[model samples]
Target: MKKILTLSLLFIGLHTYAQKAKLELNLQKDSTYLLSVAADMDIDQLLNGAHQLVKTTVTGTTAHKVTAIKDTLYEMEVTYKKLGMHIQMGDKEMGFSSEAGADDLMSKVIKIMINKPFIITMSKRGQIVEVKNIDSLFSGMAKEFPQVGELQLTQIMAQMKQSFGEKSIKGNLQETFVIFPKAPVSVTGMWTTLTTMDAAAISVKTLTKYTLDAITDKYYQVSGAAVITPDKVPAFKQSNGYFMRLTQATGNYTAKLKIDKTTGWVTESHITKNISATMQAKKTATGPVELSYPMKIAMKFTGSDK
Candidate 1:
């Protein structure tokens, strides 16, 4: 009888341990990638619990021979929470915080959304939780940023233009265009729109798709567009409502992104893995491009305690 009692107690203890909830997360969004760039940054917030979330500003300034000379900044109020394997965020509430790397007008007024890593974890009663390592999370999200070599925005632009020029479009204003060349025509800029309608229009189509044409040996016949029509969009709990429409390539593709719905800003988004052929040779001749394995962009999201 004593042995039976002991067994019963052990089982009860095991059950209790299993019942303790840690943190559950379903990344509502990583970020919305409206356009490709030398780098991506954004600011966002989501409300998971009654009083939880973190708000802050971010800035990233890099100069290369190819793209813009001006620096970039992101400022935002961010919120996050966990609920039974589901992590969420919104514009109203936030529970995590990160200090500014640099304090300035451009940095304070902007919120960075892409390449920011954050951890999410829940407490016993599931009332409190956390999101950390946002900068790293985003920075480390993709494993295949550059199969050949990482390039500065300026260099990326320079290569793009050298490969294909006049075919691409230019504007001090907002617009979209395509370039047909071997490599995608290179485009470089820090694009910010002036109005909601303009943002909506820009969000729907890719601005430019060709760069280093002779080197890449590919062309961007970009088509379609998706926009989030404004309509009192709710918080993260059920804020998935938005207008999206885009052209297809007669095949299947996976889409992922991080979004700040409060301001209709798309931080970063991408079709599953952007596959590209590669050449086994590291150093290559300055002329014809060698061939190699297609690049695979591996992305993962991690969660931790607040």
Candidate 2:
């Protein structure tokens, strides 16, 4: 009887040890890292209650490099390496690719954007602090698409500036920042945050909750769930005698992040998001019509240190 009791206690202790663990982030200055991100997006348009009509799918891959310029600041560079898109409407289908001999207009545009570089500054906590070279990049694009008039160019620049401006950057920073507790977190530990973004095309407010799920010698696994709602929707830009107005928008996201225990860097992460929106549109022939669009976006990121 004594031997059996001792064995039972040992078993309970081993199980408890295996079930829970603590995790904390460890970061250092002057570190350079590279992250490869791949994204897949699907959008479907519904009109008159029809479930399927027009749909688009896009897949892209990009590399982001970050070098610590200061103890709490980093310079980030992003380069798109591959992009592919497919569009479907009834029996008609179209495709675009950033590959040789793809004559589609979107293909050409994708090619132009693929190799071009975008640089931004970010905080150590993953907030985008500043987006550099807005005017120069758009000027270069204006040269490529000369048919775009000054008014349209101005509107486009306005949109871009609104998205990358200081206020917007702070909002983005909040959304992207991973909030860790001041003390080490055990498997049962959890944290939550709320953020509002003033997006040019559509504003968003999100509430997210994160939990520490597991920990190993190499990395810590964190899981997050968020509810996203549209706070504001800008008047849609008109093009080719067609205009659109957003009516409603709502979404949710689930994310998984694997952080290196030693470096406190996110070594791998994946996020899945679903959004649904209704819009009113007016075309030259089709008067005013209401349409619903549902979109899904999935992204995966993997990182390595230099």
TM-score of each: 0.18, 0.69
Error of 1 at 53 (Å): 37
CA deviation > 4 Å runs, candidate 1: 1-253, 256-262, 266-271, 274-276, 280-284, 287-306
lDDT (10s digit) by residue, model 1, range 1-306: 999999999998666444321111112233311232221112121223233322222112211111111122111113211111112335552222223453332222122322332333321111112323433322321242344244443343333232112211121011211111222122221121111111211112222321111111121112222222222221111011222211111112233333222322223434321211111222223333232222221222221111
Clashes of each: 77, 0
lDDT of 2 by residue, 1-306 (tens): 999999999998767555644343344444444444444555565545565545556555555566446666767665557777777777999988988989765566557666556666765555566766533333466677788687866665555455444465457445555445444556757877676776534567788888888777788888999898878665553544456545466788888888877766677777777767665566633455544354333333333332
Off by over 4 Å in 2: 1-32, 38-44, 135-139, 142-183, 239-241, 282-306
Q: What is the C-alpha lDDT of each candidate?
A: 0.24, 0.62
> Per-residue lDDT for 142 in model 2?
66
Clash count, predicted structure 1: 77
